[model samples]
Target: MTDPLVSLPAFREAAAERLGAFAHTTVPDSPGSRRAGVVLCVVEHEGVPSVILIKRAYRGRNAGQWGLPGGRMDEGETPEEAALRELREELGLAVGPAEVLGRLDDFPAASGFSITPVVAAPSDPGPLRPSPDEVHSVHHVSLARLAADDTPRWVPQIDGGHLLQMRLRPDWVVHAPTGAMLWQFREVVLLGREARVADFLQPDWTRN
Candidate 1:
């Protein structure tokens, strides 16, 4: 039997009712600020509502760190298009615009991009064929795990601000802006609460 808590019907219903009604915040792009889009690709895995993540190959500045399936938007592409394209390029999930559920806030990342996290569910959510050139590994984080009360933690930063951290595992933790994004997704989408993460500090530590 499928767990209704994590079933596709519930997910779709929540997005339609909550996400469609939630007034998501967006950051205005400033000069010199780049734009990127990330897909919060949700799926039903093992009867749990799960989201996809990628451990990037040791290739970029933040290589080997965890991320969603996305990249910087192309000149003519919308955020939704960029997100879906990246999902295809990096994870082989060729979902179209119809799969996009809604969007969360625009996180102004310390890394210089104003990132829009697009919530989506592939029509054929499946065994992801992650690109070897991009992803070191793929992970499915269950909403049940995310909704746990003790999942998010605040760690002191060198700058007197606090950085948000959450354990995907004791060994593999994700931090803001990814951590912030996930936390908001949990609060707003999963649990259907009003929450924002603009004040969450970007991480000061390396994933490794």
Candidate 2:
């Protein structure tokens, strides 16, 4: 028997209803900002709701970090379109626009990029093949793990706002903006908490 809380029907219903009800907050205007798109791809694996993440290739500014599969938006492309395209290019998963559930809060990276995270629930993500040039590995994180009350920790920040850090694996931990986004998804979509995490601070190492 599947866990009712992490079952596909409940995930879809909760995700759709909560995401549909909330109005997404966009990135604030900033000089020299570039637009980027990221996909919060959700799927059912072994009868549990899970989210996909990628360990970035050890090259870019955010090299070797676990984040969503996505990149900069192409010319004349919407955030939704870019998310789908990146998922295909990075993970070889082609999810159509119809599967897109909604958008989470826009995250502004310290790397001069304004990122929009698109939420989508694709039934089958196909055989995920990670692009060596972009992704080092892929992670399928179960929602049950994310919903645990002890999952996220409050780490003190220089600015007095506590930074959020969540464990993805025994040895792997992720922080905002990926951590913030994931926390928000768990709060609003999974538990319907109306929780907010954008104001959370990023670690000094990621503030490039």
Candidate 3:
């Protein structure tokens, strides 16, 4: 039998329901550790479920890497607040609180930071303007693409957890905490599995 046709509103409502079933929490901030917030901006492009990502500017610690649009939250700002603000700051996309779908588990970064991933679905993302100082380029990645067979692999670590390698193309590899978060998003939001990727290790290149 063929699957039923689901409209975008129906998809968003169902996605919110699935995401809301879990209680999301933030990792305790370690004293003197950096705190950052990233967003998984889900948008429907040509009837395919997709998320927006940005290539980091080629100067910072994570230079030339693919990542979610976000930055360190201003003092006294919440993660959700930070995510939305960063979206505007980095991509010139204004999204309201009601556009947010849900939050994923908190991820502790090996780079001495605790990061939060906020999921949002905006009905229409107007023109995209990437900030030259923070983003090199912006990419719209579809769920169907991310779920492809050759996209992800598990490399065992010395510790017990596995390192998740998410490939955007043949030459590009996405490292945690971005990889871990995307893996979680794929597993939970896309596949509906109770998956967790908080303990995954970052690539050695991200340790600077």
| lDDT top scorer | 2
Model 3 lDDT tens row, 1-208: 2211124465477568768996766788657988888999977776766778888999877898889999898999999899899999999988889998898998888877788998888886677889999999888778776767788888887877777889877766787889888888877776677887776878877766
- TM-score of each predicted structure versus truth: 0.92, 0.93, 0.90
In candidate 1, stretches whose alpha carbon ends up further than 4 angstroms from where it belongs are 1-4, 158-160, 205-208
Residues 1-208 of candidate 1 have per-residue lDDT tens digits of 4442478767766776677988888788678878889999888787677888888898875788888889899999989898889888998887888878899998888888888998986658555788999999989898888888888888886778877888877876899878888999989888888999887877554422
Tens-place lDDT per residue, model 2, 147-195, is 8887888888676777788986778788988888889988887778877
The TM-score leader among the candidates is 2
Clashing pairs in 2: none
Ranking by TM-score: 2, 1, 3
lDDT of each: 0.82, 0.84, 0.81
Candidate 3 regions off by >4 Å?
Answer: 1-7, 157-161
RMSD of 1: 2.5
Worst 10 residues of 3 by lDDT: 1-10
Model 1 worst lDDT run, 10 consecutive residues: 199-208
Question: Compared to the true structure, candidate 3 yields what TM-score?
Answer: 0.90
In model 2, where do residues sit more than 4 Å from their true spots?
A: 1-4, 28-30
